[model samples]
Structures are given as C-alpha cells and as structure tokens.
Target chain A: MSKTKNFAVVLSAVVLVCCGALILGQKVNAAGEGKITGTVKLDGTAPHMKGIDMGKDPFCSKAHATDPGKMETYVVGSGGGLENVVLYITEGLTGPAASQTATTEPVFDQKNCMYTPHVLALDVDQKFKVTTSDQTTHNIHPLPNPMTGNIPWNQSQPPGAAPVEKSWKAPEVIPVQCNIHPWMHGWFVVVKGPYATSDSNGAYTINNVPPGSYTVTAWHEAAGTQTQKVTVAAGGSGSANFTFKAK
Target chain B: MQRNNLRKWSSVFGAAAVVAFAMPSSAQQTKYDFETRMNIESHVGNITGHAKDAKPDYRRYCVGCHGELGDGNGENFPWVDPKPRNFQLGVFKCRSTPTGTLPTDQDLFDSIGRGFDRSNMPQWSTFTKQERTDLVAWVKHFSPRWVGEKPGTPITIPPEPEVTPERIKAGREVFARVQCWKCHGVLGQGDGPSAATLTDDLGRPIAPFNFAEGARPKCGDTDKDIYRIFMTGLDGTPMPSFADNIKPDEAWDLVFYLRTLMSQHSKEKAMAKQLGLKPVDPNAPAGQQ
Candidate 1:
C-alpha cells in the first residue's frame, strides 16, 4: 500500500515539473520578441501628380468613367506623410527570422489598365500571385537588376486567363510594366527578413523581431533610400523615423 | 534575193519600233511616277509627324500580319509558317546584343529592308528610309519595355577569318561533336527526335529553327548574325550559349557550314522546280488540290 502511494505521488510531481518548464519556455520566447515602428515623411511640397490617359483602351477608359486614374509615383498625405515607402531591417537578424517565409501569398492585381498597388514588397522566395481583372490583355514584364541573381520574366495574360504564381530567388527591386500599356508601371521590392510598407499615414511596423540592435532602411522609389540605427529592449519596441526631401 | 529579205526584215523592225514609241506613255508614266511620289511624301511625313500618331501606317501595312495589338495573331497567321513575331512579349530572337536585350534601331531597319528570307514577312525596301524608321518607332510603342529601358549596346564582332575547305571540314566535326543534329535534324530541317519536346521558359512548346528553309532567322541571316547566335544562345528558349564551349574560329566555320546548308537547300529546290515538280504547300488540306 505504501509503494502504491509513493508511485502516485512521484508521477504527479513529474507532471507538475513538465508543465512548469513548458510555460517557462513559452514565456522566454514571448519576452524576446520585439517590434520596429516608424513613419516616413516628405520634407517639402508634394509634386503635382499627372492624370493618366486611358484613351487607347476603351475598356479601361469605361472602367474609370467616374474616377480617373492618376500617376502614383508619389503619394503624399496630411503632414507630408508618404505612402508606398518600404521599411525593412537590413542587419542584426539571424537564423529563421532572417530567412523566414511568408505563409500567405502576396497578391498583385491588374485592373483598369493599372497595377492596383503601385508598389509591392515581399520576402525572397515567397510565392506571389499576379491576376488581371480587365477585359483587355495585359503583359507583365518584370525587369530585375541583373546583379540581383533573379531571372527576369515577361508574360502575357489575356482576359479570363488563370492567375500567374511566381517567386523571386534573390532580393531585388524589380520594375514591372505592361507592354500593352506604356504608362502602366510598378515595383516589386523583394527583400530578406522582416519588412513593411508605410500606410497612407506614412506609418509602418515590423513585428516579432528578436530583441537586438539593428539597422532599419526606408526606401522610396522617387526619393531614394534612408537608413536609421535602432535598438529594441526585451518584450518592447523600437522606433525609427525617416524624412525625405521632395523631388 | 538576200538583200530583198534583209530589207523586208529591216522594214518590219522599224514598224515594230514605231508601234512601241506610239504606246500611251502618260498612263505608264503616271502610274510609276505617282507611286514614287507617294513613297517620298510618306517618308517625309513620317519624319515630321510624331511617332505616336503612326497608327494609320501600322494599320495599313502591319496589322495584316502583326495584328492590331502586335500579338502576332493577325488574319494571315494561319497561312504563315514559323509565325509572326509577337511584340507584346518583348522577346526578340534576333539581336546583335546578348540575349534578353532589345535590338538596336539599326538592326530593326536592316531587318525591314532585308526581310526574312524564308518567311512571309516581305522586304519593305520600297518604303522610304524615313518610313521604315517611323514603323520601327510605332512598333516599339506596342511594348512598354522602351519606356525607361535603354537598348543594349551591340556586341563587338571580330573581323572575319578566311574560309577554306579545311576549316569547313573542321566545322563539320564540331557540329557532330556538339550534337547539333539532335535538336536540328542532320539536314538542319528542325525535325530531330527532340524537336517535338522543346518548350520555352513559359512552358509553351517551341520548335527548333529550320535552317534549311532559308527563312528569316530570328537572329539576322548575315554571317556575323549567325556567329552572334552561335556565341550567345537565345535566352528563354531551348538554345543555350556556346561561348564557353566553342572557340571563335570554330564559330565562323560553323557559320560557313550553315551557309552551305542553306545554299544546298536552295539548289535542290531550284532543281526540283526545273524538273516540273510542284512544291507541296504544307497549309493545303491533305488529299486535295
């Protein structure tokens, strides 16, 4: 009877220890997580955006009967806040965080003879989808910098065609254009590690970074690139702001 | 009697000459001069007018083969072999520069003047130089690739080495060594065992170039053009760069050998025609005239 009681008591103690260890491990992982937040602002007057002429394709022109499309090269907002600025950590991240893959595919859509998002960012090797929702045909030609080791591709998608899924093998800032429409242009900013594009308010956040000191970079297509040094404490956040001179 | 015969023949010749001289000169002159004048006027107009406004010329000449959207699926596509070039994709097979680069304006001009040797695309040499230039510019507008991209600089071609019998024999050895006959048939007819399985980078089935047809090669048909293709294999297709494998002199030899193949094919075709053998049209329905 004594032996049986002792066995039950020992088993309960082991279970309690295992539970404690598991909780402790999770707590430690949570504690090390940090985020980088920042805003990108233009320092001067915003340039006048030019309106697009969709006269070539009747379908595109009819689609934008109510609201005409304009050049999205520079999207400025209140307080000179900039949009389409990509912010990413260029240094101080290692292992899985540095080479992490995105679970969801980033969608790039072509509608009304224009790329929906003028600027897009994705992790290296993450699959992205290209879809067209226009009656007219569109040719997607992405010209990557040869030095980036990414092979360039040009494909044509006619109306009602299946979506094209592709990925970049290396980090690059590829310029995509539609051969059918000379004015249709966009950028595919592929990068390694955590990255985010600034919203209309010019604010961005790159979360779940391991606690450390790092160099963050903000890249605007028209205004060039700016970098800042930041440090994050355990279970806390870091801040990095960038200001660009209007061109 | 001989003198009388000569006199009779001379009189007949004189009468024939008079008849020829009396023929309506204005009608023939007007037809010929009007065509020349129109050609000159269109050429000059193209130079002054903006290239973006060249739609009329494009519609008149290129739309029948290149399509309204430059998709190479025009009304004549069914009748054309090797198909017309699709500009929307922006993948030009013929270029003096490396693969994946745009051909120079001069290259396009030369192509327009020379035309493809075997293809349905006829030489537009009758068009004034300025008109051809305008056509090139209009064609370029079909693709947005020219918006921000600069054309690739042409590769430097070395001076041609002397061609000799021994050199051609060496080229034949190189051809066999490289297994050129695998994709291109032994006679360069594009009918090798592997020709059926070739696909491009986009997974679309593509055929090997038929050299014996003497058609407009995706690359130019000049010796230098052939050499360039041999050195820098076409990208996006099954062709690969042999710059690393073949020596420069050997490439020239291969070019000479290819020229011979084309000439031999031309000779056989001529001989067959002389023998009254009608050439079979591939597009014609089987078992019918």
Candidate 2:
C-alpha cells in the first residue's frame, strides 16, 4: 500500500513539474514584451455631426443645455485626427499574448444621455462594466450578431442604479443603443488579442505585445477597416498609422 | 505485393471519399443537426423529457410557427406582429433567470403552457405535462447555447406580504424612483414620454405594456410572474430588471401597485380605491413625492 502511495506521489510530482515547465515555457516566450503605437487621421473634410435633440427627456436636455450634445459618428479632432478607431492585431499574435484575456475591467458609462467614449474596444472574454451617471433612465442594449457566438442582451440602468458587469464570449462589433433614447448609440468593438481605442487625439498604444511581426487592423464605425503590416524587435516598439477618408 | 498495397490504399481512399460526401457542408445544411442534440433532456420535477420524443409533436404543432430549423422563420413569419421567438439565438423574453442567461427548464415549461398574451402564440396547456417537458428539451436543442452554457440561477422571490394602503403607496414610491413611467407612462397607459421611440431587440417599433388595456402581459400575469418580470426583466426588450435596485420586500409592494393599474379586478385594486392612491407624480423631484 505504501509502495503504491509512493508511486502515486512520484507520479504527481512528475505531472506537476511537467505542467510548471509548460507554463514557464510559455511565459519565457512571452518575455521581452513590446508595444504597437500609432495615430489614425481623417484624410478629408470631416462630416457635420448633427446636434441631438434631447427634448424628450427633460433631465437629458437640462444636463446638456449649455454644452449641447452632438452626434459622435465622426469625432475629428484638431489636425484631422479621427477618434474612437480601434486598433488590434489580426494576425501574428501567438501564445500567451494571443490567448490571455484582459483582467482589468473597462467602464462604459452613460452620462447626460450619451455614451461616454462613444466607442469601447475590448478584448474577447474581458470583463467590462456598464454604469449610468445620469438622473434619467437608460437601457444598455448591445446587439451582436448571433452567428458570432456573442448573444445580445438589454439591461436598464436607472438613476443611482448599481453597475452591471458583463463580458463577451467572442469577437464582434456590437452596436449598443438605448431604446428609450433613440439618439443614444455606441459601439463595443470586441477583438481577440491585444487592442486599444484611438484617444481624443487619435493616438493608440497596444501594450504587452511580445516582439513579432503583425498585421494590425484599424476599425472605424462608419469608415470601415484598414490593415497595415509592421514588425517589432525585442524590447522595442512597432508603429502603424492609418488615414481613413471621411464620407 | 505492390499491386496488393495499391488495392488496399484505393479501398481506404474510397471509404474516405464516401464519408466526405455523406456529410453536408455548413452552408448547404439548412436543417438543424438534430442527431447531435437528440440526447438533450429536460427535467421539470420528476418528469424527465427526451428531445427525441418531441419530434412528432413539434412537427405537428410548433414547426408551423417555430420553423424547420427552429429559427422562427416558419411559413407564418410574414403574418406575425411581434415575430415568433428564434430559438436558435437562445435569448428569451420570459425568464426567472437574470438577463443574458438561458431560462431554466421550468421557466420554458411554464412559458409553453402559458403562451404569450396579445401575440400569435396561443396557450398550449392542452398538451400533457410530459409532452410539454419533452417540448422544452426540443426547444433547447435548437440553440448551441444549451450545449455550452447552463441556465442562470433563478432569482430569489420572497414570500408575499399582506397588501395595505401604506404598502401600495410605497409601491408607488418605488415606481417613481425607478422612473418606470418614462416608457410605461404615469398611469401605465403605454404612452409615456419615451414610449414613442421604444423598439425591441430587432429594431422594430414596440409599444410598452398598457396595464389599463385589459390584456394579459406577454409573460404570465400572476402575482409571482409580475414580480419575476420586473426583477428578471424581459430580455431583448426595453423593460429592464430592477433586481439590482429594488429590494426583494419592495418588489412585492411594487407588484401590488402595478395590480391597481391593471384593468382586471384584484384585491390590491379594491384596497387602492379605498386608500385613494393616485398615479405617481412624474414631475415630482426625484424622491420628494
């Protein structure tokens, strides 16, 4: 009996050592992490973003009375920099960098009857929070293509409501809208690997990308997608800039 | 020897070719792969339902509206207002579970028997309990979600409390706080300020339920069902779950207030009449009413 037990103990040690080595091997491959950084700009004159009429909801109208909410379909910053474009590695990402799901939760906020950030880029299976900061009621409904394996859901966030935490199972560009406020619209750009959304100045940095050649794809809501190829060296950075023609 | 080896290889290749041709490509396969899901079973108490057992019943009844692939694209698709549910997506409006999760076997069982009110679906209570249980498994087999995911844990509903004038009034306060009137209207008239703009998951124009219309809710209209509706929410619609905001005790109070709004006579309505409970003041500052 003790001999059998000893055999079992030895077997487990072997299995543990093998599993640890496999995990450490993957970590070693994931070392020398680099990043991809770039700016996305509009090539032509930006379209006119119509001002929203929040007259339906008194609270929404009052909150934005002074500033006045405008459409976010095309938020072109100074120097024709396009905002809200998501950049992600569509190819060449492998091992831990490719399979790792982001643990940090991103917040998609509804404030003053408009979705904050306008476009939220997320890693597939990464948890995110939906929060409401307005006095009025808003339903956060993300409609994803059922074929993509990401199911659609509608949840209401009233004033002072607790945050709803959720995550997507697959990569899809889901259109989120509030049924109560038809003018409210946003996008949840879910991607498989490392991703970043273009900031106010159209700048983005996809961190923790182990050094490798990659095909980075930039996706815009209305302007469509563009791909660029780049290579990164150990402990260094790669850059890919994109310019989308405005409609 | 070379000739024998060639003959053996040819036979192997021939069998492989036959197998390949027998399997239908995904694009050409319009029917659901029922063979893989025939083993799916549903349990409602002691009743154990086999998906295989419901095929004949589904063909005779449900297939007319639910479709051959259970995609809700049956021949009756063009005639319906709010279209029949596409079981393939697995997202349902009636669920005891929270939003974004599969409904429990019992929830689906109840939905089949209760049917949807004011919609094309008629109550299928005529079917035996065993038949309905089998049908629940059949409904689930259409979605890959059943194979990959489990039904969400059903939300907890506290025991019913005695309805009083104060409880009814407190329910009104709960209604005001959540601003249910934004789409449901102050008097539950389905003509709230935001009602005109409301749409379902499909982007089709959908009207909020008018409690005064004398029509039963799409989900069941029982007291427990009403509590579950607001708590779990009608997914794929404008109605949201108040489970996060409304306490379990207060949920019962709101349920009673909603009872008063309904055209149907109820004990709560009789009590509200005696108490002179008025419609919530939508214009009242947040909690001042």
- Residue B240 in candidate 2, Cα distance off native in Å: 1.3
For all predictions in the order shown, the interface RMSD in Å is 42.4, 12.6
Off by over 4 Å in 1: A1-31, B1-289
DockQ scores of the candidates:
0.00, 0.24
Q: Is the docking of candidate 1 incorrect, acceptable, medium or high quality?
A: incorrect
Q: Please report, as a residue range, the 10-residue window in candidate 2 chain A with the lowest summed lDDT.
A: A14-23
- TM (chain A) per model: 0.86, 0.89
* lDDT of every model, 2 decimals: 0.69, 0.87
**How high is the lDDT of residue B204 in model 2?**
84
Model 1 DockQ vs. reference:
0.00
Q: Please give, for residues A54-159, the per-residue lDDT of candidate 1 as tens digits.
A: 7655667888889998899999989888999999889887644554565568889998888978899988888999998976556566767543446565555555
lDDT for each residue of candidate 2 in A64-176, tens digit (9 for 90 to 100): 98999999999989898899999999999864466667779999999989999799999888999999999888888898976567877777787888999999978899999
**Model 1: lDDT of residue B44:** 30
